[model samples]
Target: MKPAEAYILNQPEPFKSMLMHLQILIEGTFPDVDLQFKWKIPFYYLNDKPFCYLNPSKKKGYVDVVFWVSAHLTKYNEYLISENRKVVKSLRYFKLEDINEEILLTVLDEAHQLKDKGFYKRS
Candidate 1:
């Protein structure tokens, strides 16, 4: 298995389940995305550019679906968490049930479009 897939499979309960579900949703939505192990997490890339990552914070009791070029995202801002960081935003979930499939899908679609337009190239 790839390191990215192994990372998800190795996570403990709740986190493990959440990551798996997220993995399915992301991969299902973007069949062309590349799943790589980066920064010790599962990072998804579209057209060789960073798209988003799955970060299961066991200590924090939540998984974050982090988007790379969040500054350009215009939709679903209410669902994203910045945590004072710049250039990135994330949809956080404490449990599988906490995931809103519609919101996640829409945010992902928006992010995907941004990537297609080379938004990641901007400062």
Candidate 2:
């Protein structure tokens, strides 16, 4: 198994399941994308660069779907970032009930598109 998958599988509950779902979603969206385990999270890679990441927020009790370098892209539809600043510059946070199938698909597809177009970069 890949390091990313192993990391997600080893995490505690809620996080593990949530990350698993995201992993599956990302893979299904871009079958050729690469996954990297960095910064204690699973960072999805495309064209050998950081694309997005997944982490479980213990306090918030929800999974964080992070776009490592998302400061430049504009938000569309319901896809949005957690904060208004450039801090991490990517969408974060996902609740089990808030996880709509269509929404997830749209985000993943946009992520891949952003990565493919070199719109974002690893910091």
Candidate 3:
């Protein structure tokens, strides 16, 4: 198994289950995504650019699904956790039951669509 997979599999409960579910959802939504272990976390890339990442915040007891180009997600702004950052936004999940399939899929789809548009590209 890849180190990224092992990282999720080794996480403590709630986070482990949540991360597993998210990985499945992301992969299912974007079959072409490149999953890699970067910065010691699971990073998803699209069109050879950074798309998003799955981070397990064990200390905070939640998993953060961070978007690399969150600024362009104007339609989903209400759903993001900016944390005062300039370029990224995150969706936090404290429990497995909190996963919203429709919203997550929509956000993923929109982000994927924007991958080649350069809206989220680094300067």
Predicted model with the maximum TM-score: 1
Q: Which stretches of candidate 3 lie over 4 Å from their true place?
A: 116-123
Kindly list the per-residue Cα lDDT of model 2 for residues 1-123, writing each as its tens digit.
878888888988767777787788788878877888788778877777777777677887777677655554454534666566554544454455566667666666766677556564444
Query: RMSD to native for every prediction?
Result: 2.1, 3.1, 2.2
Q: Across residues 27-61, which tens digit of lDDT does each residue of candidate 3 receive? A: 98799888999999999987667899998998889
Q: Give candidate 3's whole-model lDDT.
A: 0.88
* Candidate 1 error regions (>4 Å): 120-123
Better of 1 and 3 by TM-score: 1
Expressed as tens digits, the lDDT of each residue in 5-112 for candidate 1 is 999999999999999999999999889789999999999988778999998888889999999988888899998999998889999999999999999999999988
Instruction: Write down the TM-score of every candidate.
Output: 0.94, 0.78, 0.92
Q: Model 2: residues >4 Å from true position, as ranges? A: 75-79, 84-94, 120-123
Candidate 2's TM-score reads 0.78
**Rank list by TM-score:** 1, 3, 2
> Which candidate wins on lDDT?
1
